[model samples]
Each structure stands twice: as structure tokens, then as C-alpha cells.
Target chain A: MQTLEMGVAEITMRLISVIETDEIFQNVMVRGEVSNFKFSGPHAYFSLKEGEYLLNCVMFNATYRHPSGIKDGTVVKASGAIKVYPKRGTYQLYTESILEGKDYGELYKRFEELKIKLKSEGIFDKPKKEIPRFPKKIAVVSSKTSAAFHDVVKTIKKRYPLAGILLFHTSVQGKEASKEIVNALDAADRSSADVILLVRGGGSIEDLWNFNEEIVVKKVYAMKTPVITGVGHEVDTTLVDYVADRRSPTPTGAAEYATPDLIELKRNIDISFSRITNEMDQKIDESFDLVERSKKRLDFLSPKRQISIEKERTNESFSKMIKIVVEMIKEKRSSLLRNFEAISHSKIVRTTELVPERLDSKMEMMKRTVSNDISKKYLSLEKMEMSLNVHDPLEPVRRGYAMVFKDERLVKSVHELKKSDEIKLKLSDGKILSEVVEIEENGK
Target chain B: MENKKVEEMCFEESYNELEETLNAMEKTDVTLEESIKLFKRGVELYKRCKFLIDSASLSVKEVLENLEKEMEIGEDDMGR
Candidate 1:
């Protein structure tokens, strides 16, 4: 062995150069259980151990978030370049990416443990709040640039634009996602929204693990407004889903559950409008019927109707009298004819021996007497018909004469009228009301 | 609820009032004048609801923008 004086910095620098030149240590993949995991600013420092063998790991860059399952004692496969640190004369693996082991047993175990613990605490058994049937505002907790957020917004706009949307933007996955989600949920709960929707697109279990975090689940449970969770695909269920008031398989479903359909609401409004019009029309018809009934009752008590009835009675009596007079005149004419025929026949038989000239003279005298009696009977019938015409009740009215009435009673004489008394005169066409200022008796 | 005008009322408020108006109109004892008044109110509510649904547009406001700014400031302080 050649003994040479070498500075510590120089030796470390040489070792670093040799390792960098080696292809075996570059881009190597290592598998072990993770331990002593911690974060410093944007960097992560941890150790990967396999029994007594340990490898120091350092992951730089603030944007890269470690897998949620790569916690203390978690089995993982990390890919990185092995580097030697000159300051401490130590070596570490600068990890570029990390993935959960094939079994994924640790994440599942933690999920199950939290599920069982929450179930025992009755957090899952709490009564869910009822969602508003017609919400005025809806708060969405989602990533601003995510497909899930766009899907939720589109569905809500299509279904119901009446509700205003308040977006609480947050990351859906990675190490800082749980904290951001908690903050978003807190903001949504304090908002004036009627309901909140927490949504994300489809992904693997590790990609959706933030929703399964205890902090996010607790924040969902503590919300005053009703919460609807749609974190992954149809088959995916997170711990937050159990604590949410409603669970939808996808973001679109969550938006639909939060809003009322515009078309359906319009249909209901139309139905109500028709009902109102129909009811009003029916009420108007009922009022018209009532008015018609009242008018009929009023017509029955009118004075014109009573006058018409009296006129009908008068006309009936006149017709009966005329029929009796005609029958009497016919019977008298028939009796006279029979009497003349009997007298002529007796005279003819008794004068059979007498001369023909004497018989002719007697027949002439007898015919003259019978004709005189028949003429007399016709004159009397004419007089009777004239008297009947004079007795007609409406005859005077038709001839421009009026019957006066006072206090709804007929005034036959001047004694029934008084000065300053109102009187009604019924004419052929109408009636005239008059005030009597003076009454004069004819040749009193 | 009655104090708010139909034009100023939200969709939920107007919708609920419309339902109540319909129920009141259905009663057998309502007078013609009362029915007419209720009918007028019902029509107003219906028109309001239709207007809300017809001319509506989605308005989305992000609540976390300020929070993101504050978080960025916090990260800068941590770096310092």
C-alpha cells in the first residue's frame, strides 16, 4: 500500500467524480422500507432501509410531491442517481420519482384503519342535511383547471342556470392537496351557498388519496351547508364520500343532484298558469249564473207581465160571449124557417079546391111576412156584434185612448185622482208618467 | 315574503309563493274578488320564474384567489 497525505475535501471530490462516471449508480432503482421521512422547505430527506442496510435519500424541487403512501415504514420503489456529498463526506441518493410498492398494503391499511375509527366515532352515522329543492347558489370545491371542474360547471349550466356558482379552487391530489382541500371546504361552508360540491376526475387510488385524508373528511363533516362528494370514477369511493351528505359517482352527477332542471321548472310554471286561468274562468261563470237567476226572479214580479195576463183574460171572455151570441142567432133562424114551411104546407092542402090565383096571392103574402121576420133578426145580430166590439178591453188603447193608473190601481173616475198625485198612462206603444195638477169633473 | 316584489325575488322565493297561490285558489270557499287577486299574483310569479330560467346565465366567482396569494406570500416568508 502506498501511503500519501490527502486532504479530506480532495478525497471526497475525487470520490464524487468517480461515482458520477459510473453508469451502474446513475438512474438506478432502489426498493426498501421508508424511514425518518421529513420535509425542509422544498426538499425531502429520508432513509430507505432493508434490515441492517440503509440508504440516505434526498428529493429536491418544491413542485414534485411525494406519493401519499411513501410515509414512515412504507414500502416504496424510488428511482434516482447516487451522489457523494463533499461537505460531510457522505453519500446519498438524489431521488427523482417515487412509487408505491406493488402490494399497496400500507395505504389500504391506513384507509381501513381510518374508516373503522370514524365509524366507531359515529361520524358516519350523523344525520345528513336535506338539500334545497331550488338552490339559489352552489359552491364548488375543485381544481380550477381540472376536467372535473369543467364538467361540473357545464352540467350545472345546462340543467339550471338560475343558481350562481362560487368556486373554491384547490389541488385534488399530492402531498399539499389535503391541506388545500380543507381550506376550500372551510371557505365553502362559510359562504352563503345553499349547497357545496366536492368533485374530481377519475384516477388511480394514489391519485385520489387526498380525498381519503382524515383532515379533508373531517372538514366535510363539519360543514354547515349540505355537501355532495364526487371524487373519482363510478367504482371509486373515498372517506370523504362517507362523511358527505350526498355521494355521486361523477362530477356531473353531483351538479345534477345540487340543482333543479330548468325544463322541468318551466313545465310546472305553465301548469300552474293554466290552473289559475281555469279557476278564474269557472268563478266568472258561477257569477253569471247567479245574476241570471236573480234577473228571472225580478221578471216574474214586473207590472208588464201582470198587464199581459189581464189582457189575455179579457180577450178570452170576449171570444166566449161572441160564440154564444152566434149560436142563439142560428137557432132562431132555423125555428122561423120550420114554422114558415109548416104554414105553407097546411094552406096549400086546404086551398086545393080554391082557385090557383087565390093560392098565389096567399103564398106571396106569407113569403113577405117570413122575409120581414128574417130581416129583423139579422138587424138585431148586427147590433149585438157592435156592442161586443165596444166592450173590448184593449180596443180603446189601440185607438189612441189611454187608461190611467195611480198607485198601481186603475183610476176609473175623477174621484180617484187628486192634485199633485203621480199617475201612469198605459198606451199602445209604451207608458207615460204624469203629475196631476188639476182634476175637473164633467158637468158635476 | 309578501313584501318582496316579484321582480326582486329569487327563483326559490317566487316558486314557493306560486305554489301557495295555487293552493289558495283551489279552495272552494274563495270569493271571486279574492280569486282574481290570487290569479293575478300567480301570473306575476309565473312570469318571474320564467324570466329567471329563460334569461339566466352562469356566474362563477373564484373564492380562493386571495387565499392563493396569501399562501404564496407565506411560502416566500418561509424561504426567507
Candidate 2:
């Protein structure tokens, strides 16, 4: 007989191919007692034993539909395909489904019965208490040494250190766990905690069965302090979780739900502060605008403003009066010059004709008389012209003198004016309308 | 609400008072003097709230330690 020698890799490959192609091995259901059950990330690694025979099983993404009672010594029936791991040169069952044994089936039925009974009693439908938005103190009911307790403490400290924590330590799972939980909840309720957190880490159904106890659920329902439950992983919902005021999937989630985050609170405070300050600033600005408008209205009605307006009017009237006076003076002077020239021409003609017709003595006497009358007339005309030059209306105004008027009448004497009389003074360029504040009488 | 000093107020009390002060100041007919008074009070309330938040610390009660001692004594008696 010739013995065929095969390499280790070749033999392993052949074994893998044989298992993968076999119809019975490709799809099989095995029933055994579960042991060494552990989780790695999202996968479950465990061993199923029937007496001395043992089979290794691996469930990928086991969190989706993991059986409730999977633990050491739990009887389960798993359905999966047999596959050889090339790296370890070992075969394992890649499990797809698991069914708990009759014992867990009874437990599940009891859980359902209790749940329905409680629901019918309206305990589950009762209105839950409102959780404080900013809790000052929180009571934590958990195992003294559990990782869930530590996780909750760490998460709360990191998020909101303002909240004080009071631990109500107890045995979270055991024969006496339900009684201890009830006692702890009673103590927490009596404490001055704003909120109570009932928490435990994730475990198998049997491991976490204490939370499903009827006494524990009733105690949670009767708690005066609002209860927040975080008993297991996201897929595990215990009886106590339904009665709690709030339910978080994990211990860290419970802590986060109980206390507000400091960062978010500070952001809200900042928003409120800016809103208040902005409103105040707008009000102050509006007040200032109102004051400014009032000031402007007051200035428009001030006596100083009225005086300036009246002065402008008086200046306009004074300019018009000066123009008319100058025109009248020019016309009188031109007419007087024309009349003098006509009288002188007529006298010269009359005298010359008389000199030719009369005797010498008579002509001489007549010429003397005519010359004397002419001289007299010329002197009177010169006197009148001098008086006109002296009486020029604007002459005094040009020499820095003012013409005072009271009610359109020229003021010629101090007696025409009295104290407290409003009068107008015309100057060369403008006019001043003033009130007499005082009177100085010069006794003549 | 009774008039209390800002120093004597809790965080919620001070915060609520601050909100009230702001509301009063927001009224259109509020006089400048009244607004100024409310603003001062609001500032004090804000300061009190900020102080409370800044000085906060997590304090654990001593009941857990006493409970642990009682449990240890119970286990000792059981062992005996």
C-alpha cells in the first residue's frame, strides 16, 4: 500500500472544503448546555456541551437577536452552519438562531404574565414623574463594585460635576438581590436626592432576573423620587425599566439623562445674557433719540430764535426805506436846479430890454434893484440847498448813528421812549429791534 | 417672591429673579430710573448664578460607607 503524504495547509484546506460541501453539516441544529459564553465586540464566542462532547460556536452580530437565557449551564438549541477556522485549524458552528430550553420558556411566560397583569392594573400606564432639568443631587442605586456604577459616576462627573451623587449600594444580582434593591430604593426615596438612578451592567437573563422580580418593580413604581433605570444593554428591557420615570439603555445613558451638560447650559446662559443686553441697548438708544427730538422742538420755539427772525425782517424794511428816501432827494435836487436856471434866464432878458428903452439914471436904478433881488433869491436858494444837505435822512446812519422807531414813528426825543418799550433802531447796514430795559433822563 | 439678597439666593431662585428683572426692564413705559434699578439687580443675580455654577462640586453622602460597615458586620457574624 502506497501512503499519500499531504502538507498541513493542503490537509486543512481539504477538511474545510469537505465541511463546506456536506449537506447535513452545512445546515444543522445542535442542542446542548451553554458554557464559557463571552462577547467580543459585536460577536459572541461560546461552547455548547452535551455530556463529554463539546462544540465551539460563534454568533456574528449577536446583539440583534441574541437569546435571552444564554449563560453557563443554560440549555439551548442553536441553528447554524459548521465552518473550520483556517488560522486556528479548528471547526466551529456559525450560529444564526438560538432557542432557550423549557426552563427559560417558563420564565419568559411568567414575565409576560406579570407584565400583562401590571398593565391591566394601570401601573404601567400611570403618568411618569417629570425629571428635573438641572438636578442638584442624584441618588445612585447599584452594586458597590459593579462596572456600571463606576461608568455612571465617571460619565456624570465628566458631564456635570454640579450634581451631587449619593450611592445606595446593594447586591444587584443574587437570591437576596430583590429585597436589597427594595431596601435601597426606600433609602434613596427618603434621601434629599432630586432624582434616583437604578442601574446595573448588562448580563444574561438569569443573571439579571432580580430586576424582573415583582417586589422590585413595585418598589420602583412606588418611589417618591423620580426613578431612572439603566439595567442592561439596549436590547434588554427589564420589568423595573417599564415602571421607571425614565429608561436609559446603559448606565452612562442614565447619568446623562439625569443631569444637564454644563457646556449646553453655559451656551443657553450666554444666549440669554446677550438677548437681555441687546434689548437694554435698544431701549437706551430709543430714549436718547426721544431726548434729541424734544431738544430740537424746544430750540425752534426759543425766544433767541424769534429775535433773530424779527431782526431779519427789520433789516429788510430799513433797506427799502433808505432806497425810497434817496430817490426823493435826487428828484427834489434836480427840479430845484431846473427852476433856478429858468428864473435867471428870464431876469437877464427882461433887464437887457429895459436898459435899451429907459434913461441912464432910470436904467441904472432898475439894474441895481434887479441885481439886489437876484442876489437875495440866490442867497435863499443856497440856504435851502445847505439845509437839504444837512437834513439828509441816511447821513446820521452812515456816521454810526441809529434812527430809533416806535410803531413806525421816528423817535426824535428821549421823551418819546419809556422803559420796557419794544423799539426798532435802523443802522447803515441792518436793523436792531430791542426792548428798552432802562431809561436815563437828562433834565434840561 | 420675597425680596432676598443675591448672596442668600439659590441658583434657581437667582436665575428666576434675573428673568423677572429682565422682563420688567423690557416694558415700554418703564422709567429710566426704574430700569437702572432693575439692571443693577439683574447684574447681581447674574453674578450670583455664575458664582454658584463656578463653585459647584459633586458631594457624595456618607450613608454608603455606613451601609458597607453594617454589611461587613453581618458577614462576620455569619462566618462565626
Candidate 3:
């Protein structure tokens, strides 16, 4: 190393040139706890420190105009340039501006104040609207470059492809982000979306401050369509989230809440289908039961079945009468044969030789007596058959007339039955079991 | 009650009506003639409901379908 190469002026100029040439030190932000805080007229001086390291900071009168004073131990985020003092040969942060960070307690106080104001105005206390059970359209408001927007869109498509999605790109952070967000909400409100999703990924309170703006909260509160928000992470709560109809832990969760699961929908439709089918089966079963009951009643009182039974009964009687008539005719014919044989035997030759005319007259007289007796018997049998047929039980009933039976006995006349007697009236198709309350007989 | 023609009902409406009709038919004790009438109406409702369910499907219009395809392509490119 060479000694005595340059003067103090030259060395100071070179060091200052180095400090100005550096990009980060030229304009930088140093966040640390404030100490040695002093505010004189028109000028404020402080030292920012973290643990053992410290940086000397200063804010000139031009940039130091605020009613709130900076005190010791304040955690402040200061932005300024690093400068080398020519006399002291020490570097310091030139005056610019400073704001409080999370540790400073001021930002937290502002958050609480806004929360109180909005709560008092009833903006956060409005009744939530009903989210559509099956949303046909969903509007998503977020930055196009942000993962939050993609998360929601992908989730919605994967879960419910039938829903039409409309994306409104907006700046999610920075000074203008709140206005952009409000405009997006307005557009989404006027559109035909069944639901609107306001979402952004996880970030610090400063990064998410736009969502906490009063304008955005009011817009969310006044939306016609229901709004669901998943701003920031689960632990981070924004005013917009409070005003939304539904809040979720993440962007994808917001999408999930907006539409129904495809499988669940299928199950519901399946349930409806099965319910209808079961009801139809029950109805058909009832109908069949009714038909069967009627059929049984009809079968019990069928006149045709009754008539067949009566015909069989009459046939049995008719056959017996015919057998008796046949037997009588046989007896009469045999007796006539016997008498002819006796007469023929006695006058076989004498009648042929002497008086064929007298023998023939005797035979003719015997034949007429036998034929007259047979005719009389046949006429009586026919009269009995005619009477039986006239009294056939089913004849009257077949002609739309009913037969009344009391205690298993046919009631031939009204006089056979008394008042209050339980009578069974058999009709052509069915039977009526009734009690005869009053009876009017023909005049005697 | 005014009678709404069965053919005019939507799928959800028709399905609900079919269930009601079937229940009424099973619970009431009317004449055979009246039962037959109920049965006829129930059948009509059942047919309408079945037709609607059978024809139900997921439909995405052409513009939206293109949007989906484009999204798929965009996702694929990002994957690569």
C-alpha cells in the first residue's frame, strides 16, 4: 500500500461519489424501531435501529408537517438517500419521509378506528343476502396476473363447468387499487352474474390495505347480487370480507361456496328420480288392488255362474222324470204285447179259416186302448217339465231383477220377511247385504 | 284450483307435481271411475317428469366453450 497519495478533499469527494453512484443506498427504505426521537421547530431527527445496528435519520421541515408527533421506540419505515458528511466523514440517511409499520401501533390504531366507524354506520351490520343454490354465472374480480384470480377460475371450472364465468381484471394493491376494485364491483353488480367473488392472495396488511378502504366496503355492502370474498389469508380480515354475503378462507374456497358440487347435484336429482318412481309404483299398486277387489266382488255375484248351477239342478230333475215316463211306456207296451200274443195263440188257425174280419176288429180295439193310455202318461210328464222350467230360479234374476234371501232361505213373497230382518239381495254383478226396515205387501 | 297444463311445466315443477299426484291417488278413497281418472293424470305427470330428466344436460355455449378451450391451452403452455 502507498501512503500520502491523496488529500482530505479528494478522498471525501471520491467517497461521496461512491455513495451517489450506488443504486440501493441512493434511494432506500429502512424499517426499524425508532430511538433518540427529537422534533425541533421545522426539523425532526431520529435514529432507526434493529437489535445492535442503527441508522441516523433526519426529516427536514419541508417533509415534517403532521400533528402526530414521533416518539421514542416507534417502529417506523423511512425512505431516503444515504449521504456522506464531508466534515465528519460519517454516512447518514438524508431526510425524506417516514410511516409507521405493524410494530408502531399507529397503523393498528387506524384499522381499529375504521372498523369502529364502519360498524357504527351499520355498513358491516347489514343482513347478508341468500347465495344462489345453483349459480349459472359467476363474476370474478381480481388481478389478471394474480394467482388468486386463476385459483378461483380453475376451481369453478373444475367443480361446475356449466356456470359461465366473467373475469374483471383490476389492480389489487397500491394507491389506485381501491378505485379499480370499486369500479370492478360496479361492473360486476350490473352484469348478469348470479354471484360475485372478490378475492386476492395472502399479503401483509399494507399489501391488502386497498380492500380495507371505506369505498370498497360500501360498494360491497350495496351490491345487488350476493358477494363472496376470500381476500388475503385466513388470519387476515378486511372490511370487505365483513360486508360480503359470504366469506371464505381462500380464493378457491370462495369459488366452492358459490356453486354446488357436481356430484351432490347428481345425487339430489337421483333422489328426485327415485322419489317419483317409488310414488308411481305405489299408485300403480293401489290401482291394481282396487281392480282386484272389484273383480272379487263381481265374481261373487256373477249371474252367469248362478244360472249354470240352476241349469244343472233342473237337468237332474228332468232326467229323473224322463226315466219314470220311459218305464211306464215300457210296462204298457209289454202288457199290450202279452194280450196280442194270447189272442193270436187262441185263434191262430180258426180266425184265419172262419172269421178273419172279427179277429182283426179285436186286435184293432186292443191297439187303441194301449195307445190312449201311453198318450195320457206322456201328456202328464210334459206338463210337469213345463212347470219346472217356468219356476226356474235364475230366470227372474237374469232380467235385471234381484232375489232376496233371509237366513239362507229364498223369500218368495214380501210376507215371508218381516221388518228389521237382515236380507241379502243378490244382483246380476254384486250382492247387497241389508236390513229390511219396512215392508209393504199387496192388499189381501 | 286452476288446472295447469302438464306440458307447460318445467322439469322441477313437473317433478314435484308428479309426486303430489301420486300421493293423492294413493291416499284418496274414491270410486273406481274417479280412481281411473287419477291414474290417468298421474301417468301424464310421470311421463312429463321423466322426459324432462332424460333430456336434462350440461350445456356451454359456443363463446364460453371457446373460452374454456383457450384457458386449457393457456394452462398447458404455462405447464411447459
Best-performing candidate as measured by TM-score: 2
Report lDDT (Cα) of residue A69, candidate 2: 66
Q: Go through the candidates in order and give each one's DockQ.
A: 0.05, 0.03, 0.07
Best first by lDDT, ranked: 2, 1, 3
Off-target runs (Cα >4 Å) in candidate 3 are A1-104, A301-444, B1-80
Candidate 2 Cα misplacement greater than 4 A, ranges: A1-103, A301-444, B1-80
Among all candidates shown, the one with the greatest lDDT: 2
Report the Cα RMSD per candidate. 33.5, 30.7, 36.6
Model 1: residues with Cα > 4 Å off, grouped in runs: A1-102, A290-444, B1-80
User: What is the number of residue pairs that collide in model 2?
Assistant: 0
Second chain TM-score, each model: 0.67, 0.68, 0.63
Q: B69, model 2: CA deviation in Å?
A: 49
Q: Cα RMSD for candidate 1?
A: 33.5
**How does model 1 score by TM-score?**
0.39
User: How well does model 3 score by local distance difference test?
Assistant: 0.79
Q: Which tens-of-lDDT digit does each residue in A102-177 have in candidate 3?
A: 5735555677789999999989889999999889899999998999999998998888889999998899999999
Quick one: ranking by DockQ, best first? 3, 1, 2
Q: Candidate 1, after superposition: displacement of residue A11 in Å?
A: 80
DockQ value for model 2: 0.03
TM-score of each: 0.39, 0.43, 0.42
